[model samples]
Target: MKIAFPYMGTSHIAFKMLIRDLGHEPMVPPKLSKKTLTYGTQHSPEFACLPFKILLGSYLEAIEQGAELIITSGGSGPCRAGYYGVLHQKILQDLGYDTKIIVMESPYRNPFDFLGKIKSVISCSGVSWWTFIKVFYKAWEKLKLLDETEFLSHQIRPFECLRGETTKVFKECLNVIDESQTTEQIREARKLTQELLNNISQDHTRKVLKIGIIGEIYVVLEPFANHDLEVTLGEMGVLTHRSIYLSDWTRESTGYESKKNIIKAASPYINELFGGHGIYSVGHTVLYSQKGFDGVVQLAPFTCIPEIVAKTILAKVSNDFAIPVLTVFLDEQTGKAGLQTRLEAFVDLLGQKRAIQEGVVT
Candidate 1:
């Protein structure tokens, strides 16, 4: 079977490896573009969130390219994401595409169903259980490495002496990581990636602005969805730490990371986990403030309930903590120019605020 999955940061590279190792052809969707979003928005509900539209658009493209099966994650919360699988299936069926969909529900919700879904998908490939486990483990490790490399790039980009140098090395390292197959190959690639990034000329004395990115996972991770916010901020000499990454979310979903700890951080503002990552958004904002970040940015898909809730509370978090917070609502209609302008203004605000704090300017 030719399996396909939507893009979510660097996860597609890891998913491609896993599908191929399981003896299936991986039909990786092309990078998101305007046409992709168009197809998704045209077919999606008027009020659907940005991520759904983007994923649907990617799925349509993959199906057109003859993808036999599609895999996507599912949720069990009050968020509309819980119905994404069923809705997608309905939409695809209505569109006359018979491609099968496999929704990987969170193991934290139902361990048996999660395992059963994995077994069913791999069973079609006829790979032994041991081989499946090995392949999955390797893929997981690669995912962690990919996220780690990208994290390093975010930290180094703002400090690079030459404009675009960090981004250049980061793209090259992604290709290196993707080409790596064996465990030793992955290890070698990681070392090379670190050396290349660490070697980038940086001005340590530069007064860099620090920003924490918090919001829906999709926009936080997908450059296309968020109009490359991280890259934009980095080029402006801002150091950003995103609240969520593919690997971190995976660990939390698979029960390796404690949700209690994540929730504990948000308990002061939000005692319960609302649908989506509302709690996480709040908690990470608080954490960022505690860490002495200059400011925080929240990216929420329009009409996202959980984020709306978090946005409401974030205003209070900002006032009480004395940390600046900016929330940008994203939809198909969001434009790069406007977003850039808003970001520039926000950065200016943070810079002046920092100046006031340090007595650099009265």
Candidate 2:
């Protein structure tokens, strides 16, 4: 089958490798761009969230490129992600596209169901268990390395002595990482990435603001979807930390229930789950406050109930903890100019608050 899937950050790279290992021709979607959003918004319901639209756009494009099957990660929760596959399939049918949708949905309630799905996807003839393990781990390791590179880049970009140098190196590094074809190449890419980033001269003596980014996983991870928020924050001299990484999410999918620590940390603020990553968002906000972060920013797709709930509750967390919170909703129509202006204002507000606390200016 000519299989395809929507890009969710760098996870597409890993999934592409996985599909090839599973004996399918992987049709990776084009990178999210204005054109992708345009196609998505044209067909998507006006009220649907940005991800739904963007992914719809991606699927359509992939089908046009000869992808006959779609593979998407799914969730079973209060969030609509659990139903996206079926709904998206129906939408495609209504639109006259007969592409098959193969959802790798997470059945959180049943381990056997989840395993069965995994087994079904990975069960390819003429592939030995060793070969399967080798390919899978290679892809998985690349995912973690990609996350690390991004995490480190976000940390150093704000303090780099040269403007734009850090981002330049990071982008170049990603390209090299993408070109990596073997485990050895991947390892070398990791090393080269770090060396390049470390060479970006940094002035650590400068007082740089630290901000935590917590939000719906899609918008938080997909920089284009959020208007390159981390890059913008870095350019504004603020170090940014993402609350979740694809590797972290994948680890949980391995049956480890990886969010236990974040859940425990966030227990005081949010005791229960609302599906999606709502609990993680809440817990991450509190954790950020405790870590002396200057502020927190939450990015969500328009009409995402989980993040909307998290945004509402963050008000109390903000007041009780004295940390400012910025909530942003991203869509095809989100204006960059307005978003930049608000970001500037939020940074200024955080700067002023920091000044008062540290007696820099009274």
Candidate 3:
């Protein structure tokens, strides 16, 4: 099968390589464009959420490019993400597209469900189990490594004045991995990527007020969806940490069980505060506050239930910890200028609050 993966932040880079290793042709949609958003918004139900619309556009484009299968993540929880595959499948079918939609559901509660979904896809493509396992393992490792690189890159993006250097390093690392099949080669690429990241200088004296951004994966990771908010915040001398990195999600799945044991030891209330889709997000915010981050900024697409739930709980956490929290809800009609105005206001408020707390603006 000629598989296509939608462009959703750094994840796409790993997915593209995964498809190739699986002996399938991988097609990546063009970088997020105005046309993409426009078409998505026009075709999708008005309140479906921003990420879904953008992905719809990406799938349509990939189908046009001869992709017979479209692969995306699936979820099982209170989060609307659980239904994206079905929704998109219906939309595409309604539009007369014959592409098969492959959803790799997260193996959170039901390992059997995850296995079943993968088996369905592999059976459809007639891929052998041995080959599938081999490629899947390699693909998982690549994704883990890519997520690590992206997390480090985000840590530096706020401090770097130029974007090209970090992006260039990421691309180089991907190229190195794509060309290499051995574990030794993958380890070497990791080392080189780490060294490149450490070499990037940080602005320690700039007083970049730290903000925690939490939200749905797509809106938080995609620059186009958020209007380059991370870059914009960095330009305004504010350090921002987004909570939706691939590594975080990966850990949430694989290591969450053990990690929960540790965090629970520290504070049971912390675990209880975030009940569902945002359990990790709320936990991370408390962690960040303890680390002295100035504030928390939560961004979610309008009608995102999990994030909304997260926001409500975070409000209590923020108040209890005295950490200011700002929540921004986004939708198709959200304008760039409006977003900038809100961001500027948010920064100003955080700055003033910080100054008063530190006696810098008496």
Best-matching candidate per lDDT: 1
**Candidate of highest TM-score:** 1
Model 2 steric clash pairs: none
Candidate 3 positional error at 325, Å: 1.2
Model 3 Cα lDDT, one tens digit per residue, 296-350 = 8787888887777778778788888888888888877556888788888988988
Which candidate do you rate higher for lDDT, 2 or 3?
2
lDDT of 2 by residue, 1-362 (tens): 78898888777777787778778898988777778889888888888888888899999899889998898888767998888888899999999999988777555667676667656666644566677778889998889889999899999989988888888998898888888878999999999999989888999998989999999988888877999899998988999999889898877876655678788877887788997889888889888999999999999998899999888889998998898999998878756998999999999999999999999898
Give the TM-score (vs. native) of candidate 3.
0.85
Ranking by lDDT: 1, 2, 3
Per-candidate TM-scores read 0.98, 0.94, 0.85
**Collision pairs in model 3:** none
Q: What is the lDDT of residue 286 in candidate 1?
A: 82
lDDT of 1 by residue, 1-362 (tens): 99999899988889998999999999998778998999999999888999999999999999989899999998767899899988999999999999988899888788899889888888888888899889999999899999999999999999999999999999999999999988788889889999999999999899999999999888889999899899899999999999898888889888788767657778888888798999888888788888999999999999999999999999998998999899999999756898999999999999999999999999
lDDT to native, each model? 0.91, 0.86, 0.75
Off by over 4 Å in 3: 123-128, 161-182, 201-203, 254-276
lDDT of 1 at 342: 91
Give residue 313's error in model 3 in angstroms: 3.4
